[model samples]
Target: MLNKILLVCLLFSAGSSLTCKWMDRDFKQYSESALALLKTMKTNSTNSIDDIEVDDAVAFPNELYKHASKESREERLSFVAHVLDEIYALFEENQTRASWPENTVDDFLDIISQQANGVRRCAGKQTTNHHKKNHRKMSLYFKRLSRHVLEHMDYSADAWEFVREEVRIHLHKVHLLASS
Candidate 1:
């Protein structure tokens, strides 16, 4: 009886370990795909356009990255997933105004959604309430940014460019987190 119990425990541990490894690989692949899509959207123009500035009241959370570094893998994944969700909503809301190729925009949004879904699966949570304050701040930041892009930007291209840059920066941070 003792032998049987030990055997079962060992098998379960091994299975759990394998599942974790598989999920990590899947998450990494999704993150990489999202980054690649962002890269393809890069523009060569360095000309400065008077773009809508980020609101100080809901500025990008630079400190969140530091906190994320210390967080558990699932916590970090959850935060990134939430951020991706917001980005998807932002782009989807303004899709009609973007001058980028229709397929490219669609693919970008699709990849972001997939990445968010992959992380949420690994974390086993649809949304996290751990850093509730930070999450709320982020949500507001994106909302204000989107409004600015829509109403303040001089042209549709400027708005799309701003969104692209912000997405690329956030995705790059997520990629670094995954690598770590």
Candidate 2:
């Protein structure tokens, strides 16, 4: 009986492991495609000074990414989902001001939404305060970025460039999380 139980457990674990690998492959493809689209958009855009002078300090939450990296797989998936959600909101809010092709923007957003859904599915419905603090910080960062882009940047090429770089960095972080 003991040997039988052990064998069954081993088989179940192996099956789940294979399932996870398949899911990861899908996640990786989504992330890669998003990154590639961003790259193409950036390349086609006019060259402008990448630096923007802002009165306030708006920074990416590196600490959040670092902490999430050390947590369990579920936690990492949750963080990526949350970040993608926030990015989607930001992009939706500012899409009107972007000079990029509308179809490209739509495709990018669609991919992001799909990727977020996949991550959330893998993360399950468990909610924890483990990432609440960093999540708030990230929310604030996007809010500030929105304000800057709308009020100050307007239709400036530099503003769009700044936005692209910030978004690219966030997507790169998501890719890293998914890869791990």
Candidate 3:
């Protein structure tokens, strides 16, 4: 009788596992969504630079600065500088990431410059396909990213400006795509 009961228990566990395997499709869908973004980025890092989601890169800095700015000027500057360092470090990280192509400074600038006006124009053109509410959300997300950059970093010549511009525009494009 014990042997029969054990066999039944094992069978029940196996059936549950099989059921879970079937239910796992939802998890796979999210992963596939992420991969689709990766594929888009990889294929058009130059064109799609506008499409990469970069808000995650600046999120911590933005939140930290929001509170730190209430403190002394020194604390604010400290937070800002730290934010700059964190964003700057992302370039090296991208080197390891598969989707980002061989990005030159020029390619970065080309994509970044297309963002500010291009986004609003694209939305306007997409009026038939998109609604105003969704565009507003996309605008807000881009605003958050832009405000983060404006608060934390300065735009001067050299690698910093190139990278900053690229990041700003890329985040905006990503926001636009996400809302759609």
Candidate 4:
């Protein structure tokens, strides 16, 4: 009886593992597309600093960033910085689009820029306590900025809730991986 129970548990675990992998397949595809779009935008922004694409290019990267290994944290950090750079550039172009004052946008951008610099500084180095701290700090900054943007960007309440959930998931992943 014990052997049968152990076999059932193992099978259940394997089944759930496969189910999760299957469910993640679609999300993974979406994330890949988002990363590609962000890369193109990053390249375009490099060529013409004034012309940043206005879409939510950073959306998919959150998924990828959540799953990235500790060894690749630097690259992920740079990826995040590039995403923020794009968003900040867009803010400069679309200041009139937001209902909020220019100062509000500037405040968020300033916070993002500081976090970006911290991430850049830690890039390509062995992970340390400082790197973890930087990630945590950046995660908090990102959540704040995301909430503000979602609210001001004309998204519906449901959309804002979706974004909030995404931010929660990403921050959870960041902290979880930081400990590991």
- Which pairs of residues collide in model 3? none
Best by TM-score: 2
Q: In the order shown, what is each candidate's alpha-carbon RMSD?
A: 3.2, 3.4, 17.8, 14.1
| Model 4 per-residue lDDT tens digits across residues 1-180 | 999999999998786566434323432343333333333322211223223223453343444454444446454545444444544443444333323444544554565455444444434345456445545555555444454444444543333333434433443443334223
Off by over 4 Å in 3: 1-62, 96-180
Model 1, residue 168: C-alpha shift (Å): 0.3
What is the C-alpha local distance difference test score of each model?
A: 0.71, 0.77, 0.37, 0.44
Q: Which ten residues in a row have the lowest lDDT in candidate 3?
A: 121-130
Model 2, 19-81: lDDT tens digits are 566455798888788988887777345555344676555666787789888878877888888
Worst 10 residues of 4 by lDDT: 41-50
Q: Rank the candidates by TM-score, best first.
A: 2, 1, 4, 3
Score candidate 3 by lDDT: 0.37
TM-score for model 3? 0.26
For model 2 the local lDDT of residue 42 reads 77
If both were scored by lDDT, which would come out higher, candidate 1 or candidate 4?
A: 1
